[model samples]
Structure formats: structure tokens, C-alpha cells
Target: EAQIMAEPSGNELASAAAKGDLVQLTNLLQKNVNVNAQNGFGRTALQVMKLGNPEIARRLLMSGANPNLKDSTGFAVIHDVARAGFLDTLQTLLEFHADVNIEDAEGNLPLHLAAQEGHVRVVEFLLRRTPTMGNKTLPRARSPLPYFGVRG
Candidate 1:
């Protein structure tokens, strides 16, 4: 009856990821549950991984999760990683080819989120990898500010 166990729902997957339960997650994936399945908030396992578990995120990405998939707010997993200052998670996402310049609805990139959160190390890492990222203006800037923070 093992095969008859109920398939993990989207909420289950989200919870497993949130709890960093790699074993359960792997089992669900092996059962062919949708890795990209979103919870009620349209958040995939990858997004939840950004909250705490880079290892889980890594496994999801390796299993072919779409790194660029956006949540309800147009925030991708990279956006979450950047905002939280999860440098290792960000690096793993980058290794999976997560778009460095992906913009949210407001035209804010991961760099913008990192800057807004005052993640200096994240910002420096992003700048080192994508120098042009800093030059881009935020959503409604009347003049080019070269950054997202409030000007002095």
C-alpha cells in the first residue's frame, strides 16, 4: 500500500521545504510530485528554500525546479535570497543560472532588494559578479540615481 499513500499536496511540499525536510522532499519528488507546484500564496519550494534551507533549494534546483518562477508579488527565489541576505543561497541559485537581472513588477532587481535590506555583503557579491547591476535605476526614479536607496 506504499504506492497508495496520498500524493504530497502543494502545501505539503511548501511545508516540507520550509522545515528543511530534505528526506521527505526527496521522497515526494521521487513520487513525481510537482516541484514547481505553488502554495496558496503562489510560492514554490524554491522560494521557501530561500527562507532557511539552501541545501533544500540546491536539491530542488538540481531536480529541475524553475529558478525564474515568480511568486504573487513577482518576487523570484533570487529576490527572496537577496532580501534575506542569504549569500550561500544566492550563490547556489546563480549556479543554477538564476537570472541576475530579473525584475519584479516594480522594476526592482535582486540587487535592489539586497540594497533595500541593507545586505552589504550580498550587495558586494552581486556587484562583483554583475558590475552593471548597480548602474540600473529603480522603478519610478525621475532621474537616474545609480542605486535604489534614498539619496542624501
Candidate 2:
């Protein structure tokens, strides 16, 4: 027989993060409920930032949430922000030193994801930081077209 683990509350810390309820999140964190905890879908507080709450994401980072944790699909917080074209969230994650070169399971980096969504400013911002990406190959292959498909 397999033992079943009870699911965490639907209104858990991450949910508070999704709602931008920093006060409740702070309280939860104080209780030591794994700041890096993922939801059933493997989404973290940083991934929830793409829901239009840069400030909440920043607060979570300050509270010690790991920015690099990925979802079940290997999508990092930066990837979510890039996909959603949330420049503010992207900048905040970058400032916290989130891994720019990290790829999802599909090998798509944040720049690649940004390009796929046609977020021009995001592409520029990521390109401007390529030298810091520490890998020469990325700067040379920074064109968005390679990652983003041609639109009709």
C-alpha cells in the first residue's frame, strides 16, 4: 500500500505570492514553511511574479527565495517573466543575479523565450547583459530569429 501525502493548502505561501500578499507571505516564511516550496504544478514564488507583481517577487527574493528554482517543465522564474514579457520582473530577477543562460527542458534560454514572444525591449536588455552571461557563444547567437519563429 502507498501512503499518501496531504496536499498543502491552496492558499499557501506561493498562493499568497501570486496574490501579492506580502504580509501573509512574510508570516508564512517566519513559520519556516520552505521559502522555496513549489506548488503541485512545481511553480515557485518567483514564477508567480510573471503575474504582474514585480514588487512581490522582489520581496520574496529579499526574504531568501531562490530565483533559479524551476517548475516541473524546467521553466525558471526568468523564463516565465520572459514568456510573459514582464520587463520589470525580468529586471528585478536580473538584479538579483538570476541565471540568464539557464534553459528550460527544451533548451530555451531566457533570451530565447523573450524572442519567441517578440518582446523587443527584453531582447535588448538581455543582449546588453550578454557579456555578463560569461559564455561567448550566447553573445554571438543573440539574434531573436533563431529562437522565435517567423510570423505570418
Candidate 3:
């Protein structure tokens, strides 16, 4: 059985991303660290990108990081990108075939994140790319209010 090494913490990777320290991250990856690992709060490097670091996110994605990997809370990279309204990052992820409809533990999809965050442009782009996007269990609403309750 392949031993699953403990995933790296989100905060560590997030900090590296925030500093745009690609070298350190590259070394860590070479050391077999989990690039998509999550932190104590269930936030992965991709999720931390939602806080504003498109360039780093792009680098990580290019380094074979799994865009579909979820944090402990089940939040996918697409969800974080959508929430952050990072159109460029979102597009890049899509180009890599990231799952657009992946949901969190609460069943909130990327559309839900875009809508809830009031990222109209992001939502529009995602909709144009994925017309059939949605969570069947959740009500179909154009706005994300239904998912996050009021734009945030």
C-alpha cells in the first residue's frame, strides 16, 4: 500500500503563495509535499487563493496541482476561485478541465460561490462556459443568495 504522506498545511502554502515564493513551493513539491493540502480550517492553497493571489494559484495549477482537490471541508479550487471572483484564474482552471459543478459539504457549487459573492461577471463567464451548471438538490437561482445568504 502506498503510504499517504501527511498533506502540507494550507497556511504554510498560503504564506508561500502570498509571498509569491515559487522556489520554496517548488522545493516542497519535489519533497513530495501535497500541493493541494489543507490547513486546520480546511483551507487549501487553492482556497487561500480566494483571498487574492491569482499568480501563485496559476503557478500551483501549472505544477500539476489538482484543481479539483478539496479541503477538509470539501471546498474545491473552483469554488474558491469563484468566491474570489478571479476571472483569469477561473478561466485557467477551466482550461485545465477543473470540475465546475463540484460542491462543498453543504452542496455549494462554483456558481453558488460566484452568485453569493455577487461576482456578476464571474457568474456570467461560468454560465457561458457551463450552461448546465448547478446542484440538483439546491434550488435553481440565478443569484447565489440561496447558497450563501446575501452577497458577501
Candidate 4:
């Protein structure tokens, strides 16, 4: 009885989001599962969601997933989306009112991570939306130059 009444650990939701399984996610939401529940990893469905799928993000956000909730390292879903260069997902998150300026534990904003990772499009998009670019400096600067090398 206690297990039934306990708040969902979000393990299933996290897994569904991680896999980008919109059908399963929809089913879970229909069942009235908590959209923002954290899993054993201390991460929410949005936190572990597949960054490449904007529709999944849209669904989760519409279901009341808190986009600005950070994890142990203070990294939010926006941070991951920016770092991973998922422009669509980022757009969806912003549409849902995710704080583009929220800082991580290291004081790095999503813009910093986007710039450091050499996601030119993401940087440009974030630049247009982010009011402040010079928020906090990274402990060790990661040049976009390295990203180019990897691409090359």
C-alpha cells in the first residue's frame, strides 16, 4: 500500500524520456504519473530526456515538467540541450519558459556550454535570446577549436 501511494521515483518516465518513446510517455502521463519525479539518479524525466527530440520535450513540458530543475551538479535540461546542440529541443524548452540564463554549479550558463562546445547555431540562437552573454567564466576554457578538430 505504501509503495502504491509513494510518489513515483520516475524511473519509468526517465527511461521513456531517455529513449524518446513518446507513446510510452503519453501512456504514463495519462495514468497521472508525476511528471517531475526524480529517479534513483536524482534526475527528473526532463533531466534525462533525449535531447534530440523536441516533441518529447514539448510533451513533457506540457505535462508540467520543471525545466529549470537542476541536478546534483546543478546542470539542468537546458544545459544538456545546449551542450548537445539540440536546437529544436532548446527552442521548445524556451517556449515553455525555461530559464536560459540559469547558471550551473560551476556558474556556467547554457550559453557558455554552447559556445565552448562549438555549436555555432546553438550559440547564435542562444545569443539572440540570452540577454547576457558574459555571465560566469569557465574554470578551464574549452575552445571550440577542439570541437572543430574532432569534426575534422
Which candidate number maximizes TM-score?
1
Best by lDDT: 4
Cα lDDT of model 3 by residue, 1-152, tens digit: 97765655666776676566777666566666667666667666666654355667777877667888787767787887788888988888887779887878887778877877789899889878766555354444544545445542
Q: Write the per-residue lDDT of candidate 4 for residues 46-138, one digit (tens) a residue.
A: 999889999999999999999999999889999999999999999999999999888888777787788788898997888788644445443
Judging by TM-score, tell me the better candidate of 1 and 3.
1
Instruction: Determine which window of 10 residues in candidate 4 has minimal summed lDDT.
Output: 137-146
lDDT of 2 by residue, 44-73 (tens): 766764356788888878877888888787
Residue 19, candidate 4: C-alpha displacement in angstroms: 0.8
Query: Lowest-scoring 10 consecutive residues by lDDT in candidate 2?
Result: 2-11
Q: Candidate 1's residue-wise lDDT over 1-152, tens digit each?
A: 34577877788888888898999888888878888998887888888763657789888988889999999878888888898998988898999999888888887778778877788888888867766654664355422234445452
TM-score of 2: 0.78
Structure candidate 3, residue pairs in collision? none
**Residue 13, model 1, lDDT:** 83
Per-model RMSD to reference: 3.3, 6.5, 6.5, 4.9
Off by over 4 Å in 4: 1-9, 134-152
The parts of candidate 1 lying over 4 Å away from their true place are 1-3, 134-152
Model 3, global lDDT: 0.71
So what's the TM-score on candidate 3?
0.69
